[model samples]
Target chain A: MSTTNSRMSRKRFSEPLLGIGGILLFLLVWEAVPRLGLVSARFLPPASTVLVQLVNYLGQASFWGDVGQTMFSWALGLVISIVAAVVLGLMIGSSRFLGRATHSTIEFLRPIPSVALIPLAVLLFGIKMESSLLLVIYASFWQVLLQVLYGVQDVDPVADNTAKSYGLGRIARVRYVVWPTVLPYLMTGVRLASAVALILAITAELVIGSPGLGKQIGLTQSGGAVPEMYALIVATGVIGVLINVGVRIVERRVLTWHPSVRGEGIA
Target chain B: MSPLKRIAYFIGLPVLLIALWWLLTLGPTNFFVPKPLKLVETFWTVWASDRLWTDFLPSIIRLFIGLAASIVLGVVLGVLIGTYRWLRSFTEPILEFFRAVPPPVLVPLLMLLIGINDQMKIVVIITGAIWPVLLNTVEGVRAVDPVLSDTTLTYRITGLARLRYLVLPGASPQIMAGVRQCLSIGLILMVISEMFGSSSGLGYTIVLFQRGFAIPEMWSGIAVLGLIGIGLSFVFRGVEGRVLGWYHGLREMQRDT
Candidate 1:
């Protein structure tokens, strides 16, 4: 509505005020929904109940363990994916012939939803963290690999020619020329892959019964601990927000030199 | 990159992989690595059964409904927020929080209220897929050139005409990208939701096959999933090519200059 009009300074942060208002409104509704008997309190449980559970969970060592286990899998899976994707993406993407050759294979493999592999993971590793890692790594690998490929391919041929004219060696060319241009894409990939890695980690734990918050959620659900389940779900949402904001900060800080990050007020 | 040569090169790797798989399963094939030939036979056998229809169609249909709902809802809300700066600000935090809640995590919560059913599955899919579409649409709509708006306004182009001629085309490329992402996310949620409680669908069928020790059936289910995955993306690309041809052309022209 303000697209054609110039806005005054007071207008800038007003929306966030509205956002705060909206969240407060939502919490009010969440609190009221059960208390007002809109739904059975036994079924929906009041937001207060869930919040109390969340507070209680914060004190429990096992709750902390679940959080730690989740973070560990997420970190480990992300690291494995980043290493594999970057190394393989760089190697394959550097050689024009190899890149072209792998295009079909990449297209074929990229779309296979990782959840489909849950049963396979289960058959292989059962409910261990490896089961989660298998799906997590496979899902996130494509996100990073594809980004790396785009990053490598995005390297200017003019820059390539200039580097060749200077007789730079293969590894040197990549280190000096390719790395700078691709770093932006690589960072983007990592950001995207990080989100995916988390989602997959949760899904794996929930579906395959791997050890994490997801499994905990499953446990609470079947055990009829509705408030505790909601608490765990909220805990997950909090982690997701933190992961997203954390990644955004990291990307902004790391890529301060990149024009997109440097010039943008908005991500 | 001639068509024939491209096709040849494309088939080459898959063919080679298939051949290698056939070779690897030559003697005493393990339970995990079903012989390629045996898998093919089992795939057909399963496909011929009524179970195939029950599992396959519902998964696709649920995913389709979810993707469609998310796209429509996302585009509407995204455009509204993007165009209205005030709306964008107030809702941004809430949207961000909702998005961060992984869709699958909602399955248990949803199951408690809604029970294990197709509706629950569809809702989960919507939750998972909506983020990309909404975010992308916001970006696309927000990026619409102020100059174009001015031109359309100066020409006395009103409301529907302006939106048709100016806004939609400008925002389409990004919208398409979002839809592509949404499709994949929706598919993932569809399968995950099924794995938990439902009686049928690809996910339920796969988990069922797995637990039942029907490895061949499980393999077929997973194989079908891969095919559906590729098929959906391929179709998305084709639709994108048609819809965004103008955007592509404009970018290419600018590149040439």
Candidate 2:
């Protein structure tokens, strides 16, 4: 038993070590390619140089400002989309006729890639926060809406009928029977939307030249700041990783009562 | 459930929305919002010309190439990593980091390294679109039933035979999910790469129209992109239905029992 426990512990320890070793190997290769002059040092600077630039960015006020702009757009867009989608989803998803009437329209609109709206966004808003928000909202809204619609549809007919027999009002029935059923799906939607909103926010800034780290990266590239451009890209990657982790944590917490979450604990 | 009812349910909302747009834009108060009819006319004139071959065709070809490359690379690498425990551990963090990085963020760096050309655009799409396929494939491969694997081992199945009979089919559902994501990412990257420092493509032409203040033309371009997106999704559904038919049958059998 002790031997098995020790082996298990050792396995856990080595897992992350393997991951770290992989990253270290990657960094080493990156450092070598430029240092050994195999590739142009100007374009692909040594990994150390990019790391140093990333550290420098940490101390700069302008870097924080850019991060703040990106986050603000992301948060605002996500919030707006969630509010709009939840309300509309609930309304449309509750009625069979309404759901059918809108199914084809939603199908048509949902597949329209939000990036295709860049021209309209640029023309209407022109390198402003609204442009980023528009793209972010459009891209993420469908994600949440679809999930919410499915969730509402999944509400148990027996439970709903039980509530109706008990003289529960429409609002009361929704609060009691429907809300619990939909929470899990809504959580999934939020997780998907959060990542998509961040991507769209950055894309809008990168392509439309809005004020954010994406714009900063674009400026650095244009200005020939090779290391800085790499640094900003790394920053964006880190942000993406952190956002994913944060949403996952939130999903777990919010869905603790969900069977899927409970099933994980058991298995 | 009748045919007429289905038609009405599907078409009613869209017709109403278009009619509303037409009514609202009748006075021409907002210059940015073009009338639906005028936009359609501009779309025909703009795309029916040489731009169809010069811009739209190239973008489509690049999209297809990038998607094909991502599928081949992602599936091959995913299977190798998934089949070996050590490889899975070693590559997990690196894959996660790269996947998290918005594909758009890589555009500038790729532009610098590869120059603003067709090759660069294709590479951008591959980098962005590859992740979904690769990650999903890895998960799918890993989820192959242990009992089934043991059975294959008992039969001494190995290499090409094993992969063809077990591994590929087991991982295909997840692979299809990845491919679905890959399609959208490829489309987005194709447009985005063209937007940056390129002379001709769908994205470039749209930007050009916007900059030139050709409002109707720009709207038309966006409409074309939407049509393409819808068309691709239909093609994907057709492919998915055929590919996953056996899996669905198995699922139905399980539910029945």
Candidate 3:
């Protein structure tokens, strides 16, 4: 047991180092390919050059503005969708009639790719932040709404009945019983929605010519600023990594009492 | 629980919503929100003709090609990496980085590198759609029952036989989930790619209509896209049912107890 524990600890410690080594090896290849003229440096810039451009972007106020714009739309759209989904999911999921009534309609509408709404968004809002918001909300809304509905359906019937038998009102029962059951599912929804929201946010800007990192990427590509384009793409990747990490951290913190999180460290 | 009640509940909301839309846009004053009847008429006129062959077919073909490529590449690489612990650890960060980058961002990059062509569009789809399947396959492979693997080892199972009989079946459910995600992501990337510089696909035609103020026609394009989305999902469900039928049966049997 002691040997196995030590071996597990050793493996865990080396894994991150292996990951860093992999990244470094990738960077080395990225640097070598262009430097060797295997592919023109004009198209695929050396990693050093892109990194320099990324550093330059960090110093620029306009770059921050673009990041701010993209993040703002992502956050606002995600919040709106979560709020709407939670309220509606609770309402629909609690009542069998409402759930049945909306089932077909939801199924019909849910599969519609949100990017297909870009034309409508452009027509209504015309490349403004609202256009991005529309796409983001449309895309992320279904992800959370479905999860919330499932979460509501997952409420323990025995506990709910017990609450009722103890003279709990509808509101009280919902507050104490429904909310806890839904919290973990809701967190999962948020994590999923956050990724979708960012994707739509970037996509809207890329297609609609809105103000964001995606647009910056487009402009750089169009203007033949290859390194800058690569830099911006790298920046978006970093943001994506950060958002994922942030969501995981928040999920752990918010769901500490949940069995999934509680039993995690023991394994 | 009655069939009549079930039918009503299923179709009632959609019918009522369509009726509400028809009533709300009854007049000829609102150009943006075309009447439901007008949209149906426009849908038939625009999509029921040769544009179906030229625009719709090509978009679908590109989507499928991209999806097929992604599935093949992702599954092959994912299985290889998943089979080996050292390889899995070494590639984890790189895969995560690639997956994190929104696939749409690849559109401009690919357009520049590969030029504005069908190849670029397909590559865009593959690049973005590949991640979900690859990542999910990795997780799925890792989750395969250790006891089963030990049994295979004891029986001297190896190579193609082991992969076919054990690894593939074990990872299939997760692989299906990834493919489901890949389908949607591929569709999105398809539209985004065509929207960029292409002139002959479904997305381009829709943007053109929107640009020319062919409001009803653009709405028709969107409607067709939605129908395609619905159709793809239905087909996916059929395929998944076949692939995961045993898994589902097992789950149900477990639940029965």
Candidate 4:
């Protein structure tokens, strides 16, 4: 058993290292291809150039300012969505009659792409950040709400009965038992929504000409500042990566007891 | 709830909301919030003038073309990656990078390289829509039960026979789910690509109206697009239900436990 365990650990360690090596090889090729002139430098800049441009932008005050605005709107929109979705989701999910009544309506509205509302938003809010916030809320709210509804539904009935037997009232039982059980699902929904919100926020700016990083990227591109545009795009990609990684860490910390998370480590 | 009560509750709320909306707009709100009745009137006017069909057709056509192409390419690539372990190892990071990078960010790069035209719009839509299908297909194929695979091997099934009998059916449900998601996302990207750059399509119509300060006309275009989204979702759900009835049965069985 000891030998088997050690062998398993060794294999796990080496496997991820192999995966990392493969990724490094891909990046190396990407950096090399443009420098070799195999692909046009106009279309595909070298990775080193992109890195340099990224560093230059990092030194700018406006870059951080844009980042702050984008993050602020994103967080505010996400907070509003979570509050609204969780409250409504709990009310609807706890009652069979309410769930049945609202399910069809939710289904109808849920599939409408929030991006399609950019025009209506522009009409309603003008080229303001309010429009972006509204769009993010719309895009993300339904996702969390649905996940919450499902999470509530997945609560074990016996556990509820057991809590009741222990003299817990409905609200207390829900607070102690149902909330903890569903918190993992809630976190998963929030993680998914975080990514969606970032995309939609940037998308809102891109389409409606809202003042954000997306607008900055658009300005750079149209002004033929190719390297800067590429740099800004790379920065946006980094932001996405950072958000994903940050959310994942939070998810891991919050859902430490979850079977899926407990089953694997970053090795 | 009984079916009748459920119907009443569902239908009544939206009606009440609409009535409230109409009431809110009646109190001299001008361009900020157009009256619901006025918006309806605008819808009729737009439909009557035939700008609706002319602008809408290009968007729909482009969307369908992009979706069709992406579905074909994503499935092929997904299957290839799934079937070959080495390929999966090589491609996973690239897939992760592309999936994380929002599609609209690519618009500037694509426009710079390819020029702003129908092809560029189509390419953007395809790139936006393809990843979900591809990733899901890979997962679906990878998740094919090893026991079933071993059974196929025991029967000496190989190559096309193995794929046809074992792999395709195993992945069909996930593939369908991926297609549904891609279609929804593709529609959004389609409209967005047009809104950002194109001179034609429903998106362009909305932009045109908004820029012209024709709030009513813009609302009409948005309403029509919303209906299209609703219609597409319903159609896909129906198709998915029919195609994956067995999967649904299995799901129900699992739920019963």
Lowest lDDT block of 10, candidate 3 chain A: A209-218
Q: Give chain A TM for each model in order.
A: 0.94, 0.97, 0.98, 0.91
- What is every candidate's C-alpha DockQ against the true complex, given to 2 decimals? 0.79, 0.88, 0.88, 0.54
Ranking by TM-score: 3, 2, 1, 4
Which tens-of-lDDT digit does each residue in B59-149 have in candidate 2? Answer: 9999999999999999999999989999999989988899989999999899878888889999999999999999999999999988888
Candidate achieving higher DockQ, 2 or 4: 2
What is the docking quality class of candidate 3?
A: high
Poorly placed runs, candidate 1 (over 4 Å): A1-9, A265-267, B2-4
Cα misplacement distance, residue B185 of candidate 3 (Å): 0.6
Q: Give the Cα error of residue A261 in candidate 1, in Å.
A: 2.0
> Model 1, B142: alpha-carbon shift in Å?
1.0
Q: Please give, for residues A1-267, the per-residue lDDT of candidate 4 as tens digits.
A: 999999889877765676677778877997999889987888878777887999998899999998887878889999999999999998998898788768777887888888778877877788899999999999889879988998999999999899989999989987998898888889979988998899888888777778889888888887888888888887777788888889989999998887777888643
Q: Which ten residues in a row have the lowest lDDT in candidate 4 chain B?
A: B89-98
Taking the tens digit of each residue's C-alpha lDDT, what string does model 1 give over A1-267? 465344543566576688898788778899999898999887788888889999999999999999999989999999999999999999999997788778999999999999999999999999999998999899999999999999998999999889999999999999989999899999989988988888999999998889999999999999999999999999999999999999999999988888897679653
Q: After superposition, how far is residue A124 of candidate 4 from its true place, in Å?
A: 3.6
- Writing each residue's lDDT as its tens digit, candidate 1 over B1-257 gives 79998887788788989999998989886888899989999999997788757878888888999999999999988988888877787788888998898788999988988888889999999989999999999999898999998898899997889778888788999999899989889999999888887888888888988999899889998999999999999999999999999889999999999
Instruction: Show the colliding residue pairs in model 1.
Output: A1-B83, A19-B90
Alpha carbon deviation, residue A241, candidate 3 (Å) = 0.3
- Per-model TM-score on C-alpha atoms: 0.96, 0.98, 0.98, 0.92
User: Native contacts recovered, in order, as a fraction for each?
Assistant: 0.82, 0.86, 0.82, 0.47
* lDDT minimum window of 10 residues, candidate 2 chain B: B28-37
Q: TM-score, B chain, candidate 4?
A: 0.94
